[model samples]
Target: MPLTVHQFPCLEDNYGFLARDEATGLAACIDTPEAGAILKALDTLGWKLDLILNTHWHPDHAGGNAEIKAATGATIVGPAEVTRISALDREVKGGDVVMLGETRFEVIETGGHTLGHIAYFDAADAIAFVGDTLFALGCGRLFEGTAEQMWTSLQRLAALPDETTVYCAHEYTASNARFALSVDDDPALKARADHIFALRERGEPTVPTSIGLEKATNPFLRAPRLAERVGVAGEPDYKAFGAVRAAKDVFKG
Candidate 1:
C-alpha cells in the first residue's frame, strides 16, 4: 500500500514536519523544529506520533526532541553521529531499514550539509525526507562536508527512481531556481521558474518535486544531463560533477 504523507510547516524560514498514516496510529515527525509545532500538528490531525526522525543534528531540526519525547513519549530515531547532539533514542546508520507499522523506510547517508546527514526513503511510497542534503533545483551548501562530498551525496539521491518525490527541509526553490537558470540554459527551467514564481506568489509550495522533475530542472541534477543537453566544450572530464558544484558556488542568483 502507498503510504500517504503530509507536511506541516515549522520554525521560521526553513523547517517542515511530515506525518504518515493516521489510521494505523503510526506517524513519524521528520525534523522536530519546535515542540509546539509538532504537538499542534498531532492535535490538529488527531494523530499519535510514534517516532521522531532526525535528518541531522542541526538545532533547528532537532531542538524539540527532549520536550517532544517527554510529551509524546515518541522514540527519536536518527544518524549515529547525532546521538550526542540530538540525544537520539535510536542510533542508526546507512543500509538500515526502519519499519513503522506497515510502512518501511531505508536510510541513505547524505553527508554534505552535515557530515552525518542522512535521508530516509520509503520505496513503497516513492517519498523521501532529504533534509538539507538535496533541495529543489539545487544542492545543500558544503558545511561539514566538502563540495565533492555534497556532489556524491546528491548522486546517491539522483539515482533513485525518477518518480521519487523529494521532501527537503527548506523552501529555497525560488533562489535555487534563479541559480539553476544561471548555470544552464534550459527553456524547461524558465517555464518551471515562471510556474514556481506564481506558486510562491500565491503562497503555495514548490516542493515535493519528483526525482524526474528535479532530474530535468535542477542544476545539481543536471551535471550529467548537461553533457547530453549541450557539449559546452571540455566539460566531459571525470570531475564534471565538481564542475557543476563549482558553477553553483559561483552562480550569483
Candidate 2:
C-alpha cells in the first residue's frame, strides 16, 4: 500500500508532514516544526503517530520532539546530531532503513545545512522527505558543512529517479525563484517562476516539487551549467555551486 502524506503549513514558513502507511495505518511525522500544530493535526485525523522523524537538530525541526513524544508516545528517530537539541530513540544514518509498519524509509546522508542532516526516501512510493537540504529552486546554505559536502549531498539526491516526488520542509519557492532568475535565463525556469508567482498570488503552497522539475530549473542544481554567469568559469562543479550559493546568500531579491 502507498504512504498517505498529510501536509500542513506550520510555524511562520515551515511545513509539517504526517505520513501514514495505508497498509498498516502507522504514521510518522517527518519533522517537528510545531508541536501544537502537529498534535492538532493528529487529533483531527485520528491517526496514531508511531514515529517522530528528525532531519536535523535545528530548533524548528526537532524542538517539538519532547512535546509530541509526550503526547503520543511515538518513538523519535533521526541522526545522532539530534541529541544536541532533544532526545533520540533511534540514531539512523545513510544506508539505514526505518520501517513504519510495512512502509520503509531509506535514510540518505544529506549533511550540508547541518553536519548531520539527513533525508528519508521511500523508493516504493518515489517520495522523499528532504529537510532543509534541497529546496524547489535552491539548496540549503552551507551552515556547518563545506561547499563540496553540500554539492556531493545534492548529487546523491539528484541521482534518484527523475520522477521522485520531493517534499521539502519549507515554503521559500517565491523568493528562491526570484534569485534564480537573476542568475539563469533558462526559459523553463522563467515559466516555472511565473507559475510559482501565480500560485503564491492565489495563496497556494509551492512545495512537493518533483526531482525532475528541480533538476531542469533549480539554479543550484544547474550551477555547473552556469559557471561563467556566476563567475566560476573553469572551476570545479562544487566551486560553481559554491559561487551560486554565495550569490544567493546576499541576493536582495
Please give each candidate's TM-score: 0.91, 0.99
Best by TM-score: 2
Clashes of 1: 0
- lDDT against the true structure, per candidate, is 0.80, 0.96
lDDT of 2: 0.96
- For 1-253, candidate 1 gives per-residue lDDT tens digits of 5566777667665756656663476888888877887788788887778899999888878888898889989999999767656687788777999877778889999998899999999987788889988888877777788766777788889899998988888888988888777767889999999999999899888777888898888877777666543344455432465567666677776
Q: Report the lDDT tens digits of candidate 2 across residue range 1-253.
A: 9999999999999999999999999999999999999999999999999999999999999999999999999999999999999999999999999999999999999998999999999999999999999999989889999999999999999999999999999999999999999999999999999999999999999999999999999999999999999898999999999999999999997
- Candidate 1 stretches greater than 4 Å from native: 224-238, 250-252
Candidate 1, TM-score vs. the true structure? Answer: 0.91
Residue-pair clash count for candidate 2: 0
